[model samples]
Target: MKSKYNFQVQHEDGSVFDMYQMGIWVESFHIYSPNPDRTFLEFPGKHGSYLSASYMKNRKIKISFQVETGSEYELDQLKHSIYNIFYTDQEFIITRDLSPGNILYALQNEEYDFDNITGEDADFNLTLTMADPFVYGQERIGTLADDAGYIDYNGTAETKPAFSFDVLAPITHLDIVSDDGYMRIGDPYTVEETPFEPETIILNDNMNTLTGWGPASSVDGGTVAGQMSVLNSNDFIASDYGSGSAWHGPSVKKSLSQQLQDFKVECYFRQAAYVNPKDTGRVELYLLDINNNVIAKLAMADAWKNMPKNRAEVRLGDTSNNNYMVNTSGKTDTWWNDFQGVIRLERIGTKFFAYVANITRDSASKHFRTWFTGFDDLEGKFQGKVAQVQLHLGCYGTDSAPSQAFQRIKVSKLNQPVTNQVPYIALPGDKIDINFKKSEILINGEERKDLKDFGASFFSFKKGRNNLFILPEGRVSTTVTWREAFK
Candidate 1:
């Protein structure tokens, strides 16, 4: 505001004010850290208390200063300016020269609590409260070129960035996917969904006995149940000197209690114990219809074709077992030979979405990557069609005799299907704004969010480097802007 004063505020109408310029002298500026919003609750017979949730309350800022009053005319004019800036019901963006990297969004809290000293100098103690907890930096913007599909973001903390661009062609959906997040703008059939009270059944459970499973071995590898189920090589041989058609594999089947409407199946496994990635093992989750024919296939191939570094390959919704999903990584890092991850296959209404996440006891749900079944009438193909799913892993190299360590086989079912729709379309020549901070979508400066799509997640960029893949490269010029935030 006026040549970088000590304290300043920006109003919603773009007007700015500096503290010293308005004859205001600061005595002491106190900023208090907010108390945490969680409550400590004791269990029925437990010794220690536990916190319910983890978050902080709103922050409080107190600005104590004095305003000068000289002549009668000067006194009236100065007090009027103070009344105009403070004592407002609106929230203001406040800044300070001390915290140059941070800004505050606050509203006037409580009363002005001022005193008139001899009608010459007026002392004022103003309190402001902030709903947002973090201190923010100035907004920095960048552009993604025509051929680029990735953005490497570096920030002190995670931020909700805004995307803006003019569309060169008409597009129904602008789907952006990252390792930790997913956002689809202008998706016609699928909206934001949250499964309430999901019922998850552990099918082909290895912790118990592998009862429903059978081996239709093309090669010599067999299955064994232990701490982790092992789909090991049958005997010692070289890597793939035999026929590929009659491959080594194990398949398990389970019947659904009722006809399926929506489903989610996950296979948690380690590719091998001592070594895994180099064995070139493939774990295919087959969703079969009532007649035991395959309807959908989500496969995770570790080190395809026995290459060392070519790990983290995933295939989705393929009938022929080929055609890897573009830009899908099953494992978080490719170089690790002992990779432990979870493969998830889900159906929302007619659309099928596949997601993979690297999991560990310390860091659960790490690096989530997703791929959609971008095909036509996938709903009609498997509405009431899916009866049981088969978990199969096969075609392993006999040298390592790698037994794929199968962990948990969890099949969670939603109480109801997700049919909510949020259609956010950006036409040719239209300027698009996807505001994750405000959780708002504005096309050409107009808000178009409706009740059907309420509480939709706009998705955000996490801390450190966020690698994002925004597809169909050359059609749209992109600009992303966000402020660096301190915790």
Candidate 2:
């Protein structure tokens, strides 16, 4: 539209003209506010006038005035009508005065109809019966026995390695030990057939218990991280390593695959020095897939740093299958001690993130970074299947692989997450669209109709002012525009 327009001055507001004189031929009408009193109509004049407008404060329901028609009589009547229409609301209440472009100016105030609107005023509240993203009624997944595991973290040669697989409550702390000397804390070590104490591995809520099994009189200092639980006696693995100085563990599978689509996984680990960053010895957090051999391993050491936690890595699938790795390489300091790392895997897309932390009193060192690997890069590997997950104390090596202890190990599945959106203002005649797939939009005290296909057919604005609800669609909403009466 052209910036300039023509206009003709009609009778002033003080005149006695009973006719609806043309106050200003608005080339374009921009409703600053939908509420009649708080609204400011901006548009170019049909009679050679610029589209500039301004608001007049210090009045009861302050109105924005513009130069047009020069007819005070018509302007006063028009202004009065607009003010009356909004101030005496039939649907909405002009509870707050709004700036010209404030996005919320379009929504009706909560106090619109004192009789219709009950309950405390609230932000957006969505309810879904089919596939709600917010709240669900007691929908539990996975058996109790399928959610917990154990590992050994006690360092020593006199203790036996022990672990559990309870369903009542998932075990979050474990320690496996054995009679051995000199455990590598870094990578590149050969797997050895050593005497491991299968009975010494204990899963407990406290980490100090494992200190007693410390390597032949060494000062044992470690923390048992995460929540704790023990299901039943039959719910554990005795010695899955199976002969020849090996270790074995029963596995637990994640229940909600589709629902846990876009979520995160976190855990903590403390491996023995031999299994550290030197010999590539490390702990196995979880075994996601077994069909195509897609497992996630936490490497103790890589081509990076020399600390067990320094060379921390997340390798998906097996080395033979594309070796998809997300490394937190070279980020080690005092903060790496007793810290947590998170891996956020996106459900829809083949992508994930990793976060690391270093312990510091009541907090942690804020330094953290992540690396991403695409599906195409892992084509020969696997798509996105996470089946079996085991918290192997000493992951890479065999049962004869000297025992490694873990102070704490907890796993939690992220639930429906919330994201914020940019706000925009709606004006009179503006059309809007809202989507409510696994949710419903609640405006005031009622549910809004779904507008997925027909673009906003379920919404209409009153002549003065009104407010409505829009539900979360997991996507951006459609664009809305204002309509002029004459246009």
| Candidate No. with top lDDT | 1
TM-score of each: 0.46, 0.29
CA RMSD per model (angstroms): 25.0, 28.4
lDDT of 1 by residue, 1-487 (tens): 2323368888854568988787788777777875567779998989999988877688888888876677667776887787788655567888897776678888876766458776677787878888776678888887776524454556655678887767887555565566777666654432364222334443535434455655322211334211213333221112222323323444555666655656777767665423544455555556666776656665555535545332443344344543344344424445334445666666667656655554433311223233334333443744545677666656543533354545666676645533553322555676766778867665654454542133246766777666666654556778888887665
Backbone clashes (count) for model 1: 6
For residues 1-487, could you state the per-residue lDDT of candidate 2 as single tens digits? 2123221111211112211232322233233322122444456765544534532322121222232323545445554443333332222212111221211111212222111122321112111111101111111121112222222222111111111111121111111111221111111212342222111111222232322221111000111222122223211112332222222222222322232333345444443343444422334454455352444554433222344443456665555654545555444333233333333333323555544432222221122333344433334333455543344332222323223344443333333312331111221222222212212222211222331222222232223322222121211122222321210
lDDT of each candidate versus the true structure: 0.58, 0.29
Summing lDDT over every window of 10 consecutive residues in candidate 1, give the lowest-scoring window.
Answer: 234-243
Candidate 1, residue 363: lDDT: 16
Q: What global local distance difference test value does model 2 have?
A: 0.29
Query: What is the lDDT for 273 in model 2?
Result: 40
Of the candidates shown, which would achieve the greatest TM-score relative to the real structure? 1
